[model samples]
Target: MVTEKNNKGNQISRRSFLTGTATAAAGFMIVPRHVLGGKGYTAPSDKLRVAGIGVGGKGESDIAEFAKGPADITVLCDVHDSRAANSVKRFPKAKFYKDYREMLDKEHKNIDAVSVSTPDHSHAIQAMAAMQLGKHVYVQKPLTHDIYEARMLTEAAKKYKVVTQMGNQGASGDGVRQLMEWYNAGLIGDVKEVYCWTNRPVWPQGIPWPTTPAPVPSDLDWDLWLGTAPKKDYVNKLVPFNWRGWWDYGTGALGDMGCHIVEPPFRVLDLGYPESAEASVGSVYVDEFKQGYFPDSCPPSSHCILNFKGKKGKPDVKLHWMDGGIQPARPEELGPNERMGDGGNGAIFIGTKGKMMCGTYGISPTLLPTTRNKEVNVKQTIARVPEGHYVQWVNAAIAGYGKKEVSSPFEIAGPLTETLLMGNLAIRSYDVRKPKANGNGFDYPGRYIKLLWDGPNMKITNFDDANQFVKRTYREGWKLGS
Candidate 1:
């Protein structure tokens, strides 16, 4: 993500040489992985020292995969001891801490890279803190909670000159490469529209916020787990998971599955920022014959349409996102017996000449009418990620910033995340309520209105209230930036 300029004579700046006499003399705190006394592999001392934050659930598996690469899992940090139990048991010798701030403050020198698999809310702050310390960072997908956080982290990666990879593993898969190859070969022609759908919120959503106070678990630090989110009473079933429904914490289904499903067309078409966004969200029933407007939680289902600006004589593309079990219409070319987009979650590209579809992680891609898949042969133009996503980051970190290429680097991921989050902004704005002058129920001006966006300015030009979702104010004691 970040590149260092070379010197005119040596072609080696402080970072380029990895670990030469000049690099050592420059006093760089973190050391890149360098081969030692081995022709094929690196010694233990030369392995990348990685510290993992949120070492639970996805975080647990993330570090485990990194360890399979050229990495040594040296430290594990988690707000909940119960969730991190498996990681701790596996990495018995690795240091453990409850606070990421304390871990980075005390052990930044000991670790060369940091892996963040925390909730969406805390991603920007934690990753930013690591990059500022000159640590190569691998952060989980939907990169950050808000659009501004995504933008900030993208800029910081370049400014800090650190290698960075987002956790959209599908971006590194052979499936996406295959899709790119077919599109590049004119098998899909020029895609004018795209559809990505998911059956998410397999957690609760479209409901009233829980008010009943729940006892905080003894093994968890409640305050630490609520990092960057607005503080309140601990609710039932809020921790470990299910927090994806809350606006104060999660980005709902878009943040949950967008990175995987959207990355295929995004890479295939080389998409940039969108020019506008609009959404239609499904409502919940608070009582018989009455619709509920729960701004605190995400809707049960939503369909968002984002219009991207065309370039170089190409027509503007409309990217559609559906979630909470909502899906686009099945293509007529396919038979009734054939499956549509892996049944529950998948994406479809509607092009001028033909259509193609893929399932989650961009797997099982095929052309329309099923039988055409065998007729069209696209050469493998892009190299495959043999080591997979997690290990790709490990290898890239070991090779130093801008040395080895990585899939879903911040340069590509930032705009993708902002594009997805734009849908969220539209959904949130749909609930923007104003009291009627007659003191009646309310008037919702934001509902059913297209939000013109200025991507460079990071604003919703037509709607002022919608801009609030672009950036959220952090709670006290938490800050993110240089």
Candidate 2:
């Protein structure tokens, strides 16, 4: 979930070096277990030797974090040779594999945990394989490519007694903790709805048209990059980072940024599965370059609404998600330069009493109104939140498996992830035309069916076809857990 803070505050630049472990100055923060770097370890008594799959982009930072403390980098794997090359330089003694399974089998004993930062579609397969080997996992979000895979991984994690964490580092952020604390303090008085928006109009936000085939980068192994995804000609539009807009590769906007932006409220409310999820949006354009890359698939570039029904005895909640298509009208109460909390690429929770706002990546969030409805005396007690999302995971891994609580536990993080993936399903299942009159309009916007999920069976009673898309047969050798 996204946590926003005042933009003017001392925001930690992503490129800046995180000097030390952060301490909580407010009552709502979690006391992070500080890391003593490599000095804390002596004898190897179950000290975690972790492996990393996909060491570029977010995976690069993930590897650095897990390697910081008592944990040793036992294996490094990536489809792109150069991406894996730099990681090898960092840990020269570690085994390296282009195929994740090869590393798992060859270095299984030396590895106690795996950090998975592959594309959305590969998350389940890599994570599940790691668990099958009785290895703990830290998977980036949205947890899995589809719903069935999520259930499969969740069950397998429990079955294997593995400590699991989703890479929604915001789950461990100082602002999210305060968001939950304020809710428990009845500041929002049972949030009825949340609006999450992003200016994330980058490579994945909108549908792009077809393009010419550009030369594949000499450094990347394009065939291995395709992995479980169906074979496609090497086109620039399908390479590097254009897969998110295509069905075969990425999960679009909702799948790409939902975990980061939607987590605050989902975590704080302890919201379980939604009873139903429906969507409304404009048609996506077919790209020339994507002619054979996708199965005639394109992601929407406009607004989409997703309605969710809470579990038994819980308040029904609605999530308004906006992307390339449209966005919520700016709140009129704020000043012109106020920038709707955290550069406007975040979320705001509207509750019965007041409202709260946060940024895309977790930062300390601020309470709106700064008071109760009629209480003029109330005010916000400002404070600083944690600086390092990586150290928290490193410290947990060093403390031994399942010994200390890491942020984004599978119990809460898994389901929260499942709910966001539901939005992805709604997008894939949407019937764009035939307005409300035909009972098929996504224009009702986010109004969706309540699916009766058979978690063990990995099927949805309400939407059989939708459920089928959750699990895809892997390419010959890439079959999961084989």
Task: Please name the candidate that would achieve the greatest lDDT relative to the true structure.
Answer: 1
- Cα error, residue 372 of model 1, in Å, equals 1.1
Residue-wise lDDT of candidate 1 within 400-440, one digit each (tens)?
66566677778888888999999898888843466544432
Residue 286 of model 2 has an lDDT of 39
TM-score of model 1 relative to the true fold?
0.90
> Judged by TM-score, which candidate is best?
1
**Stretches of candidate 2 exceeding 4 Å from the true structure:** 1-47, 204-215, 284-302, 310-314, 370-388, 430-464
Q: Over the stretch 392-472, how does candidate 2's per-residue lDDT look in tens digits?
A: 555554554444455665666667667766666655653344234423212322235544545435455676656646577
Q: Model 1, 459: alpha-carbon shift in Å?
A: 0.3
Whole-model lDDT per candidate: 0.82, 0.65
